[model samples]
Target: MKILAIASAGGHWVQLLRLKPAFEGHELIFVSTKTSFKETVKGHKFYSIPDASRWNKLKLIYSLICVFKIVFRSKPNIIITTGAAPGLMGIIAGKVIGAKTIWIDSIANVENLSMSGQIATSIADKSYTQWPDLSNSKVTFNGNVLS
Candidate 1:
């Protein structure tokens, strides 16, 4: 399967990378906020889009456009992300193109799902929370990446 794995830089990106083993045997095209991350993903296809947050509407649209183009061109079978803002953009883009989407909420969100995670439950095909307590009918609690 061709998977588009996207996340923002820092913790989101690190957590996304930890899921690499699960994507073994599939083609992984990674998207992040930093060009430097291209080196970290090594042999996989990598893309760096503008980093944006909910506070910046303009940049968020620009990043979404970039991600949309990537998803449109690649036509990945699945899309996944450990998110902040950019990863949400990816899910929106994938939704437009009919690619299955998955959102794994960051391990740091203990009390509740992040704003993006909450939104993803409606957008993504599968949504996961690292904390079992957060799991409900919409989001499932699977094993975490940090463990």
Candidate 2:
């Protein structure tokens, strides 16, 4: 199976990395915002997109363009994201191209999903929450990435 792991920099990337051991038998690709992450997430292809927030329209457009190029070129079988914003876009694109998607809500979202995770939930095939009871049945209880 071909797996594409997508996330933003910092904590999101850290969370996605925990799934690394699970994908060892399959091909892997990783997408994130930090160029520096190339060193940390080893043994997979990597892509970087411009980071954007709710207010950055130009950056958001540019990020979407980059996403199209990357997704088309890679054509992954599955996409897993620990997100901020761009990860939501990736989930939709992945779905359009017939990729199964998993959205892992940030551990930082103690009471609710991050804005990105909330959006991704609409399209993701499976959603996981680190906090068990806080998770709705729509969101699976996946335990902690760190542990």
Candidate 3:
């Protein structure tokens, strides 16, 4: 199985890495905003996309173009992310290409799902919240990346 794992830097990236063991034995490809991550993700295929934020419209556009190209080429069987902006782009691209998508909301968002998480509920095959209390009809709490 080919799995595409994507996330932005910082906490989102950390949480995504925590889920690495779960994809063991699968062909894993990672996408992140930092070139620095190439060292950390040594054994896997890695792609670095331009970082963008919701506030930066131009950069967000550029990121979407980059993600579209990457997703089109990779054609992953599954796409998973712990996100901000870049992860959202990956999820959107994955869905358009028919890959099963999963969104794991960052542990940092204890009170509510992040904006990207909320958007993912509409498209992702599954959406998870780290905090069990935040889970509802739309989202599930089936354990967390931190575990």
TM-scores of the models, in the given order?
0.98, 0.94, 0.97
lDDT of 1 by residue, 24-66 (tens): 9999999999999999889999998999987889998899889
Please state the error at residue 11 of candidate 2 in Å.
0.5
Model with the higher lDDT, candidate 2 or 3: 3
Q: Name the Cα RMSD for model 3.
A: 0.8
Winner on TM-score between 2 and 3 is 3
Give the TM-score comparing model 1 with the true structure, all chains together.
Answer: 0.98
Model 3 TM-score, 2 decimals: 0.97
User: In model 3, where is the ten-residue run with the lowest total lDDT?
Assistant: 138-147
Quantify all predictions' global Cα lDDT against the true fold.
0.93, 0.84, 0.93
1-147 per-residue lDDT for model 2 (tens digits): 988888888888888888799998998998889888888876679888888877988888889778767887899999888887778878988988999998999888888777777777778999888888768868888688876
Worst 10 residues of 1 by lDDT: 84-93
Model 1: pairs clashing at backbone N, Cα or C within 3 Å: none
